[model samples]
Target: MDASRQIAARIEFLRRQLVDREPGPLRDAYLAVPTRERPVLQGTTTPALTQIWQQRPSGLITPATAETQPIDLIDVYLTFEEIFGFAAGPAYPVKQLQALPLGFVLQFCAELLNALSRPGASHSDVDRAFATQWLKEPIRTRVLNELRDPRRALVVPQALMLLARAAVEHSPDSLPDGAKPGNLIGALLAFSDMIGPSGEGGPTVLGEQPGDLGREVIANQYFNNNASVPHTFARYVRRWRELPQQFAGKDGLVDLPAVYEQCTGVTLDDLTVVAGALWAAACNGNVLTPTAELETLLPAGQVAKVLALISADLETLRQAVQSERARRHTEWTFDAFQQRPVIRLGAFLLVMDQRHLIDRAFGWLPILDVRFPPDTHPRPTNHEKLAGQAIRTLRRFSELYVSEVLHSITGQGTTTRRVYDDPELKAAFQGEGQKIADAAVDYGDTWVVVEVTTSQLQRDAATAVPGNAQVKDIDKLLEEVRQIDATIQALRRDESRLTGVSSQIRRRYLPLLLLTEGFPVNPVSMTVIRERAHKRGLLQGQDVMPLEVIDVEELEWIEALQEQQGVSLLAVVQRKQASSLERTSMRSFLADTITTPLSHPQRFEGKVSKALGPLEAVLLKRKQREP
Candidate 1:
């Protein structure tokens, strides 16, 4: 048989073996198999296998249904190694195997089996084949090359165009009617905070037992960067509040709890209390029964409602896992915790229905819940059109945020949306209307020209696919870079026309592109930008400074650094521009250059609190009114 058919047959055979067996016996059988005899199973753990087996429903794992159960790649590898008796080579890490999709894992195993069947295939030959597939060089390189293709058109649609499309697609009646998106978002953020470790009564401490110490260490590593979540929440809240309320209800008087009730059929307070209880239970143990303390905190009805919203049954989870695995066949990225079907789809709780094997209870995986608004809502009718609108909204907010930060640092002299009024400059951009820089900051002799973009790297760009999506995302970013270069060129062409800056001092210009989302600022992208700039004659002049691309995270860090130490953004930019290494990202550059420690958490939380103060107050008032 061919490789594909061989894999399918192998999986079928394995499924039959596992179908009639109980989870505990199956787990014991698997663990009893000596790893010395089957070296490929070296990294497989008892806990991981037990977790996988527990996902199988009681009395439901018939021969017909066994194939439908979610298959962990590690389990497959172990099964194949035990059966085939392939020569033991280097063992793949459990984490690495776990990250791969079902399809990829099946193919990998099939390839291994095929190699072992070959006449003269030695250990080195099998290792070479393994390395090739594991690294994914062949596919990844093809995708990257396709992204650099020059023939691809780089046309980006305007905000108005997208808005018009959305309007055409959905009538006013079809738009979101129940809750204001802003209020709903605010309530969700508060709910997220309530369940977090740093919620209500400070950080929760895992016990001092031997096993607990490891758990505590893992939790600390993950949660140490506490500022990220709050900052993200604050940014989203600000963006949603500032954006035009195209989807919100007309009255706009919906409170936080009302919004939660409208969407979830439960009050935000009840949801928060229940979510906290579940979070606590999850932290304490992998599986927990409904306890007296949890019941005391929330009534049965409320608990059931909250569980319905956030938890899924084994079958539902299996389907979701299958769907996700299929979706990720093209998109190679993986975060085991974040990308788990239940977690990714806004369901953090897992309910095990097999009372015969284990008590009918909830199973908690150590995964952080980081679901966004869209994850909770129904999939939009037109995702592409709505995404465009979202991108435009983010771009506007990013520009505003960057301008405000600049104003704070350089004083009110920082000019935003400055029009090119010079006769020649106006004529140059006549066909495209008046050209304008997003913002310009004046620092005596130094002038900073800013361009803010919210262009994010698309999944296709990250995946091993030579598709249109990859090309389009790359083209959109390059187009933004081109615009930045053009603005810098225009400003330098006529220094006399520069507005809101002192004309007396000889000025040096710094070109900056501020991205709302992180972009790969590696050698390839930088080289591409430089090549494009050279073609446009933007880099020919000695006085011109190379453009710097920094994300909002770096901008926040810089702002904090400025407040703590007397470090200026201009100084950082100058140092980076002068550096011989062209591949390093702004974050790396900051880490290498800065000696003083940054008080990022303090400054970030302060800023978020200030930004979210009014909304938070309103939420608190609503909670206080609750009986």
Candidate 2:
């Protein structure tokens, strides 16, 4: 459901209108009327009433009133856009989409694209209009299913504008001087593409398909701007470029279509879906651009300045984090790693996840004082053996921690037991190839299958396979949870006695995978994992619980552990929904304790400048000394 690639494509489209590094027009130049222009219409431009009257059914407009009719084509299209709710610019709210039929948007976009490609006869040179049509339900369902949400759905209008504008901006020569795309690039092109490629369907006016549009667009985008789209796209393109024999011919031109198919798995029925998926992931919201907050705002524009500010903002944040880390000293003991009351692994996971650096933090796990026994902390030697024991002690503590927390929450009726107690299941897991659940809990009419995991083994975040080549570590971990959930479901269906539930009891299975990031990634990124699994027809049901990566207040947990002798699981889960992170308390805790020089924009700018000033001065001095 991530819209990274689509976002990338949109950004590339916008880059034509925005992201200019040169000294040029602040406003979009395409909106301005060209000094020298030729008329697209064959004859003198007539009033709107005359145009619609000509197309009117036999008796709708009589000679008595035809010439005097006040209706306008602009009014008609505007009403259509409003009623149907396909605005030519920006995203519409999910609430606004309720009135639209399912397939209408896609059908509209197709028509608009077609109309733009092969323009029709209009009375004005600036005529950019569409033939009217209704959206169907089936196409809407199909597009929605492929897209997964309204965010990408709303991008359809923006997509049309991006494409139409990019076509004009980048391939100006290709657009016919007479049939120029009008000032209403946002609205008219949106309607044009909605209609169809050439408005050639049964209800359409059917013109010759603009075959050259495809070639011109693809070539212009791919070759221009040092490769249009995200820089990440270049890496995908490089995959085929590196292995020329597999995809390229002796003539040396790479088979782009094959490469795209090979890289992203674009098939027909799911072409929209696959492309949407890749785009969502590629142009993921996590990947920030300078004008990300107000991407549409212009005139009093600051978009071009954003790229530099982003670098400054990031550097500022990095320095601030490093400073906070220096001052962040906990009185809690790591020596207690051997003891059950140890540092909260849950708290550790939550903090690192806030900065999107869990995997990197996990990779640095060996640096922890707990890795060695308390006895070995001061003068550590032969650490491997001690570290092994530490890991076992910590793991046992984590298991016990979960058991205790659940015991408090569920009271007497329900029980959460580590599945390791089951001899048969434990033996099955030990059997060379089999898998088993980490824990199982009985909680008020539900059998919760638990799988605990960390990206501790994830060395390279860039690789598809985190721990093993055959499976992503997270997927492998979740598979075991799913299997256990399924097994419980089957057993309940067949009347088997699970620990807390009797043979007569009916309990639905809820599979919970407590996943912690080992590498830095967006907190919402776990959806990419679940979605990818669902796309492959695995993990596709309401029975599968959402991957729980809830963020808890690290400081509150620390306070409770330090003073109240416990960290509350109920409190942690209650603080946020699964995959939702609230960094307010965490940030407040840090700010109250630390200087936080880069927290606000003005201060952040001042700090960044100050940090850079010294470095720049030193570098200049070094250069002078060298000369």
Candidate 3:
């Protein structure tokens, strides 16, 4: 396709990829990235992280425990599970690591060092022939976690020499057995596959020679900078803003960030972010005719903006890029490059942003309709629909589990109206474009308002959040409440979904329940949930109206039991009979134990404003339009 048509196609692709946001300051606000802090467990490094190398279970490829996993697996655990002291993830370049097997790590390290220490020619990362090569597979592979080159720079060779010198001085035994001055040379050759039949590259090899930094080489000291905070992300944000021109000027595609850094002195944590952002911004969107606002900021004004960008906080740059993306929005791209989405510059930026986003994209990005005033641009993930499914399951199963417990206790019959499913109720609550409660339960006369919610925890804690994530504190835990709060307001107006339930109960209590992936085990977390829920208005009558979130695991276990027994709650009640545990009412289980209501003083509130009140007027308009 021609350039104009190509740009149009790209804009369309972006529209499908990114949710729309308000324009101007509001859009800027929504585009900001949130800060994240990762938690780590003690006793994880050393032989523990490299247990796979130290004791590969001849037949077992996976590590025995998370602690004994490879550095790659362990790093993911550190972020996804917060099992290690790692505060955030993508762990930023893996330039340096303490827990990886020395052999595997050394292979890459040696390649990086040799590329750097070469004497004659200045090996630049820019010109592939001179620095490095640029390929689509590299971008795609890196984003998907297949490319493992850490510290994309060739500074390793310089650093390696320093390490070798230290090893020789401190303790000779620490060097590889019978090692010589050329040990680094040998390592470089072996790891780079220089000795192969074709004298070309090959796969990485792992063994004892590359295992430890020699026993004397302190693991922690070898990579003191491993745990240091990464700042390349800020530079990547700056790079993202300058992409359209740079990418277009540099041919159909741009070289990787290491090449950029080698030539321009800028650093890139994840090249994919550079590519992803480029796509989200210029190539993926219709920027052929700059927005009127962008036109005004060009040439004369653009220079100042660029200058301001240099010192601009990470959040500011992020908001600017996001705002630009929205301004350039048009339609989805119908064009393809080898069946892959193409933007001369877009592909590169999209790749970079995808690699970066799971760690630093805009915070708590709810899918299209579930948006609120306080946040925008929820991090894109493969888990959105799954999160919804999980919540639905928990709501249904939790209702059944609690209802069964109640029946065994009071001997009073309980009924559940899958009310939202009833045709009459659907008409009442969802006329044309409306939403309703996920599920409902009626325990004798006391009807409970159960609101089931599940938000995807950070798919990539390090780069998933958006904006200048440096300043924006995007707490996954905080996001849980933010999501709950967004859906909670519906409850105040959602009673209509239950019009099918012919209940003449004089008294009704709202037992608001929220559910998300994973169990809340931390007392502090429980406190935050309680406090945040109350602050958002779930804080009404503490005793009578129990407001608690569900522990997905607990309900999941109960869900499994029902499947195994191949019977409904009634049959299980009949078989087990009424024991003391059975006597424990579902109300007590939900209101008293399972949930942490608002009255409890565990107020862990973050500085976030309430979301816009439920779009009542919008819903009303839709209802009016319906027959």
Candidate 4:
């Protein structure tokens, strides 16, 4: 058999033996082998290993437990899901593979790793080993080539920004009536309400219900709670709500209340209440109930409307599954489920018969649609046009957002000024036909030059077989970096002209590049940028600080740490620079360097509340108007 077929055969054997059977015996058998004898359990400090062996079989993999693995085992499963299982046929039953206990999965993987270490093992011995060994080389190559490379992270942010802007720009006059952008947001909020921690003594959907093991598996595996949905919605409402009014002039304002009423057959206020009510009911162990249960909470018509907005029939889901399979075949890096048909139809709601409930369910993958919006229109051309417009809006928004974050970090006493607003600084660069940096902040003794870019990874670069696509994308980024380096060079050269300071003045200049999305700042990308910058003599002087690249998320995280915990931004940056030459993401760097008192969700929600307060007041008034 060929490598692919061989890999699939091994996976099928393991699935039959490990997944389709009761895991208790296997667990006991594996544990019975003394800890010293079980090489898989050796040298791992993860507490989960001990807990899993001691505790009763839970049959569910919690998010915390899943993270303890040495490698991203989820990705390993997804690789097979996309490449072999879905692409080939239902014979693979890839979704069922995820339902295997985390302990078993880890143990199996560990044993495979241990077996691979043994010298001169027979082909039959290797074949009898777990499937991970057969696909190890491909998995390893893919992980190194694509998975670990953070360039793919750029796609989701860009797609989300575009989708969001399209939603804001979507007009009521459009053909083929569909869910309004606000309705989509409402559905997302409802979905978030469903999955978020239940009220004390309230009905719980995730851990308490029968067949909830499957639900928890779906939630933990797919919708890992890196971001809070309500906070994300708040940010969206606060930011995009202003776009229509600002960009479209006096007549540009979208009446969101009217939009929601028209599309969802209920006012925004009613939708919110009904959505909450529905969440409570769904969580009350009614996963198998008909529409009647939902109707009891709201008007029949309204219930149908909400259901139509959020849920998809089995046929729709089947089609989406197929489309997703096709999408993976085409664009290997395109993993954002929001853009896929399945998530676009609705993420939280999946209509399956009682016989095909969570136990026999086809992995009810629930994507966080709030962070990643579905397509705004049916037509591809219209979607493209809106995406193009969103790019421009994103550019402007990124600059303002970065500026605001910097100003907040610098605080009230700091001198922060936009370079474009300063005539001298603008003119100084205009002579060389160059654009000035976005903003400048006088934080402590250092002069910080801020540059913001919404430049994203092109779709072609993310395709399955990117020929010249990757090269072209890298070239664009290098050019952007070079331009920023040139701008810094000019700023230093014309220091006396613009700031009335001598070139010999021992002034420290820190250049900060704020990306709207995350980019790979791995050794390769960083080395390339550094080498080019060094060749341009941008890093020659001791006065010039190394150019630090931080995405918007990291910037927000830093700002939160500074504001909430009194952490110093300058100190963080200096420490980061001093610590490593081969840079990782700023977020990862922050995680390693500082531990904040507030969790990410708390910090993010606090940040969003500042912007969402006014909007909430309006929403409150609308709610009060409800009888």
TM-scores, one per candidate:
0.47, 0.28, 0.26, 0.49
- Greater TM-score among 2 and 4 belongs to 4
User: Least accurate stretch of 10 residues (summed lDDT) in model 1?
Assistant: 355-364
Candidate 3: residue 507 Cα off by (Å): 4.5
User: Residue 168 CA error for candidate 3 (Å)?
Assistant: 21
Best by TM-score: 4
Which digits, one per residue and each the tens of the lDDT, describe model 1 over residues 447-534? 6767677676565454423334433554576566555556666666555555634277556777777777566564444554555556
Please give the lDDT score for candidate 1: 0.42
Q: Write the per-residue lDDT of candidate 3 for residues 300-370, one digit (tens) a residue.
A: 34322222212122233234434434332111111111011111221111111111122222111111112
Worst 10 residues of 4 by lDDT: 358-367
Off by over 4 Å in 3: 1-101, 104-175, 179-426, 430-435, 446-454, 459-502, 506-516, 519-521, 542-544, 551-553, 562-627
Question: Comparing 3 and 4 by lDDT, which wins?
Answer: 4
lDDT of 4 by residue, 209-297 (tens): 21222222222322221322333433343334444345443332333333334333444344343433333223343323345544544
Candidate 2: Cα lDDT at 438: 56
* Residue-by-residue lDDT tens digits, candidate 2, 1-627: 469988998887755543243345533444332122222222112112322214322223433333212121111122225334554433322222323321232223333432322213121111211211223455444433433321122223224433322222222222334553333323433533343222112212212211222222212221111111221122222222222335344333344334323332221112222122222222332221223222222211322222111112222323433443333221111111111111111111001011111111111232243343233114335455544544453343333334433343333221332232233344433445435565555544555555554433232212121122213544564464465555454445442333433545545555545432222112223443455455556434564544343211222222233233333332333333321232212222323333323212111224323322323443455567673
Error of 3 at 176 (Å): 3.0
Query: What's the alpha carbon RMSD for model 3?
Result: 29.4
Show how many residue pairs clash in every candidate, following the order shown. 0, 38, 66, 0
lDDT of each: 0.42, 0.31, 0.29, 0.42
